[model samples]
Target: MRPEHLKVLIVDSDANVRELITGWLKADGFHAAAESSGEAAMRRLREEHTDCILAAINLPDMDILELLRQAKLLDPAIEVIMLTSNVADASTVQAMRLGAFDYIVPPLQRESVGLAALKFVKYRNLIDENANLKSGLEAYRKDGDILGRSPTFEQIRHLIADAAATDIPVLITGENGCGKERVARAIHAASSRCSLPMVMVSCSAIPEHRAERELFGSECGAPDGVPYPKRGRLEIAFGGTLFLDHVSALPARIQGELVQALQRQMFRRVGGTLELPVDCRIIAADSADLAALVRTGEFREDLYLLLGAVQIHIPPLRDRREDILLTAEYFLRRICAAMNKNIVDFSEPARQLMQQYHWPGNVRELENAVERAVVVTVSTYIQPMDLPPLQTDPATLPASLSLEELEKRHLLKVLPLMKWNIKKAAEVLGVERTTLYNKIRRYGITRPLRRPSGSVQVPQQ
Candidate 1:
């Protein structure tokens, strides 16, 4: 992950120069902090996240060289820019050798010094952002919630950024095992309430009889020996996020109560008189079509609208074919490290098989397959045999396979060969033009530009 936000420290004794650079940095959309002495600047470095430093070559307490050395020792990632009146000085050359980012000579044109500082800020952000991304992926991969690095995944990341920027209820729609919870965690991690607890409620797993008490808690003053009041998932998640998994499974009564709480931003415990404030952010996920459920009156319309106000949909893995092998390799390294195995890479056939097979179970299935492969393989390179055996019977698809995915996968295999000719594809599918068009729209399928030569489609439906 590389750093994006920049904080610059100006350590010049000249208040005019400090104000001058500070204004330039603020205009450039960077945060600037000023210190009159090297000692104060060093203290600031220790307490704050200072990405770049603009230290005057002469300091009140110490030389610029000493400040440069101390700042680098504090955090090597910090890029120090030296501000000086004399480039001809020997100490300036020594400072450069000692790892100064760049030096500024006055006649300090905002254009020149500002440009140099801007350059350092851009470089600093890139470095930090990359470091952060890697760190986040490593943490997520441990939980089998690896977000891939693909164009499609980038768009998903952008959506995630938007979701995290707000506190409104967010609805995550995706097939099973598509990392819905991972996205929820990501939102919570990026939010202002990150330090607080993010309580998760599994709507499908909760017994229907206890759904109310589980979500809204129970009133105190019990008839027998119980003395303390039981806290609910919502109460525990206050000042943070409450993630509802399989939210579509909530009964109609509970759904209505949720809608009321969301509308008023207040909720009361079971058998309680006082209404408690609802302060937590709500994030709900479901594998089912909640809008469809609403149409059938199985889900509350108001609750559906509230939860889905800021919605994110993750397409099945088969739709993101480009990420398949990449994601597989990422898991391969992670799993190998976990297992302490010496396995190197996947064979070409293995890669083709993994990319072609319809990943009905999405990322979770891919991770499990890699873990199983690591366990079974004895050689450095993983062969096709190392992966778990998949049902290859095209004439008889497994009953567990969803029809939507089955047809979408079929269309993907055919459209490339048909060169994405609409009429040709329709004729091949033995469907009318309108029917094929509708299916394409429903599945949100896009045509690939072209396929590589000497490539074979691995057999799996």
Candidate 2:
């Protein structure tokens, strides 16, 4: 709602129209600029940050749709309004299809146009606020760099951020490769002990006999052939963080010792009687559900409670499909950088394959796949054949499923990729308009289409 915070660019071939709009916007306390051509408008956009753009649909030198697309590519969150004298159905629909925020017919009324612009700006601000909250939460939860605008991931990020502000031992539970370790690091980074070293001890990594010595220091000349005094992970992590990876793998004896240490803040070194006072924060992660493990008697309940002062559950990548492509792009960039490859983007089929795959191994698998693809891909763009096939098998399908049920699942997976454009979805599926309609009707996939302006309208059945 701060006028200065909102940057608007007005693009029109006619200087008079551009100046008129700019004057009106400036009078209303908005930071507005006017450009006489699409090129000038794009130059301004590139040179400075813009919150939204209002562009004439028919520019002198460039196609309006192309300009709009370029602006969106520059910043996905930037709102764009299309201004044109011709509000034909096709033009309007096409503008909306290309992600224009709103299409305005010329001979613009100052009050009505201003109100509409305000609404668009307000919608954009709400989206930005949600994204900021999500990013903050991701920082707190210690989830690795989050990249998505989806509502679900945003909420998760916010939760992680809130949890990161405390010293309470955090229990992160998720499937393997779900970035649980990244979340632990986020918490450690956000905590007061960030300056101190964070030592990670994988219970599965240490041999059973030496687990105690690994966690607690040992004294010299103590039975193991005059063992020199050595500080354990707990000692090294003093006034810092100790992340226990796969805490459930810890043997019963070590669990008891850890619990005792947590209780007294003191532990006797292995083969020695000296009790060492330790000051450190504990963060534990497990691929399995600790509560379920406790119920099944596979894990100690007291230790679970002690470690799970706060718990964060990360959903699998399949549940948050919105993040898949964003994460893939990030991994692609990283891998390309490492491999010295010029792969800048994925081909259409490659992108579709990525979206269709369920990603059972989660983000880690995606990263590995991208890395492999980067090595194999010879071209600047990665294609479907460059990446490995997904693990979905047709042999696993249910025998009794009707054709309608199968079609619906296929449509559900394809819709997000097409941005929920029914026509585009039909085109991608290689089906006619009426066939797609019948399929939509039969499947009862009646979710309304969402417009770029954040409005929803039901499709005609």
Candidate 3:
């Protein structure tokens, strides 16, 4: 990585140390700026974009640990390395506890400092790449289309494209609110009969008494005792696509009728002897596994085979974590527009909370959350307090709550404001580095350590 591309902030009270380090860093092609005190370091941090911070353990009127905390609060992605000459064991442990990327005893090690700077640059690049991928995927979800960049979503898209060219029946399986209907619509829109009206029927919504008549239109009645003819959903859907949502909910008798319609494309209206032939594409969606239902005798094996000529399964949101942040941003923009709010973005804490929560209700749940936040947020930016409390059980702490819980409840809240690292966390808790480590070890608080995959994995309790 090019050092010039990586902005480094050097904070030290000693003028000679700051000048020596700044000159070396600039000579090495880095964009380095020096600050003589903790307060000056903070001002530089706010005024400039820093990729990494090289800070001393002590500065005038401020503690180095507290400075680290403040820097993190300003930008969590900014890498911080602590410098000290005393080489005290407590200081080393305290630096890490304050969330420093690495602790060094100076006279500085040039190789280590260079390597740490490169690591920060690489991490920033990975975050950019993830964001880019999400943007590309979102570009495909135009209008009412369900677009996904995740492998599972890409597979679904490919299947939909293949299924669209044919008139064969398609069975969409997924949990409720998984956008099964959207998939069905995409198929219809891409099909050869795109010009024809696409009809939707919820088998579960129709009453049992009306289901037969609804599927097959009623016949025209003669004078007093004769019945009138009415076209059913199957006949009305001729030359178009008939989307049967919740097809598994169809009555047994209606399932038999549907099978006959599929085979012959002809069905007689009630009270009428004349058979009407209709040509239409069939698409069925069910939340449950029809094969299992068939095995249990609730659904016919033959009917399952007929309807499931093509199957498309939509994955739940929990399985697509990569898309969550993008989707949240999308919803935020859309909801803010509709609500006439000027909300521009979510605070870091708010964004992190959204990413960590398990969205059990899928996209629908996210949509609701975004809408709620947009409505309740008073400022232009949505903060964590603006969002609904995550539905986490009090008795069962999150499995990977170490880094997140610590950052949310303690580190982030104290650091950036204090402009000092160790002193800040220490002052707040009334403890020193040794005392803090003992507490962190006792409480099992994990730091925001990076992994080889460039993903953050907080240790669960």
Candidate 4:
């Protein structure tokens, strides 16, 4: 907030007023420039990157409102303080609404001038500091531990940077276990609100009856002995971030209410009359197609539009097979350190098997596999037997195998792993139970029968 870091522009028709302000600014160690008319002020604004402007509202050659408008268009960051002799009420209000930094009256006090300048200088410094931090983050991300070498991942990294620079709501879409929440965290970490709390809510996990209460707090009952006030995620995420995972699963009633709240950036508690301001940035994530849901009337179109101001889609691990071993090694190191093991790396056979396998569960599955291997490894290097069995050999597969056949085969693998519990199987497959059931019907997959001899057999279709 040093004065030497600022460039102040002074505009007034009166030489005395201009000199008076210029002298004060110079004495405070700020670089100052004086202009006698609005025309000259406009010219200076266009040519220089002035941080602040102090202008007389009664400029003889040009309208003060027009000058303010033009100054803003030139540089939206320039803070303008209007000084007017005439006590016109409407013009003052209009100027304030037009983004003037401050309005001052006659007999400008030294303390007032100095204090106003200090406020704006501090604001400028904050802006510069955030820019510097974001720049450093962009550099670190290039070599950071997020773990990817594919072009899709590189584009996603750049998208994270662009989305973090603004306060816009972001909608992240991808298959489950593809790191949607991690991308949301990256946005928040690279933003100005990095130090603030990031409140996360799983839309699909919240019970329908309590959704409203969980999102917007309830007021305390005076004589009912019920808890009077309870803060919701909206209130808790103020001045920070709110991450809505599985947003497409939000109940219909809440979707409508959320649209209104998101539109105005404010909301009322479940039973309160007051409208509370929402100061948090919202980032929503879903594995399903939200647009398709909108077309089917399951999701509100208006809310989707608001949340999708910036959309980021993460590619599933199978699509980025090049990163399989890279990520596997990354997880291997961390898991080994945590488990206090001396495991250094995976053997060539294990590495080959992992690369050959199709990671239906994406990144989360890979991490779990590596953690499992680390727990059982008895030597410095992990062997193929330490990992889970590979799904199938690509060379052994029938040449006519279609995408649908492959999907059916994977679902069959997942169902048995979940012990034929449809709910758990659905979760592991990243699909709704109904969707999983439909796929089972289409593929004619059935649970295997258990024999008294402790053996299982798949029934004939």
For all candidates in order, the CA lDDT equals: 0.80, 0.78, 0.76, 0.84
Residue-by-residue lDDT tens digits, candidate 2, 233-333? 99999999999987888889999999999988899888878788879889898887888989998888999989988888878887888888989998888
Which structure is stronger by lDDT: 1 or 3?
1
lDDT of 3 by residue, 403-450 (tens): 547434553434333343554444443323444455555555455545
Model 2 root-mean-square deviation: 24.7
**Best candidate, lDDT:** 4
Q: Sort all candidates by lDDT, best to worst.
A: 4, 1, 2, 3
Off by over 4 Å in 4: 1-145, 221-225, 393-408, 415-461
Cα lDDT for residue 243, model 4?
Answer: 97
User: What RMSD does model 4 have?
Assistant: 13.0
Best by TM-score: 4
> On residues 322-417, what C-alpha lDDT tens digit does candidate 4 reach at each position?
989999988888888898899878999898899988777788778767877898778899998888666676568898999899889888777876
| lDDT, candidate 1, 1-461, per-residue tens | 12226678889898998899888888877788899999999999999888888888998798999998899899988888888888879999998988888998888888987788767856766776878876875575343354676787788787777877889889998977677888898888777777687898889778788898889888775322256688889889989999998898788899989888889899998778789999998999998999999899898889988999899888888788888888889889989999999998999989988877876567777777788899999889999998866444344677887878888877776566456776665544544355567777778776543476544432211
Q: Any runs in candidate 2 off by more than 4 Å, and if so which?
A: 1-143, 391-461
Higher-TM-score candidate among 1 and 2? 1
TM-score of each: 0.56, 0.55, 0.53, 0.62
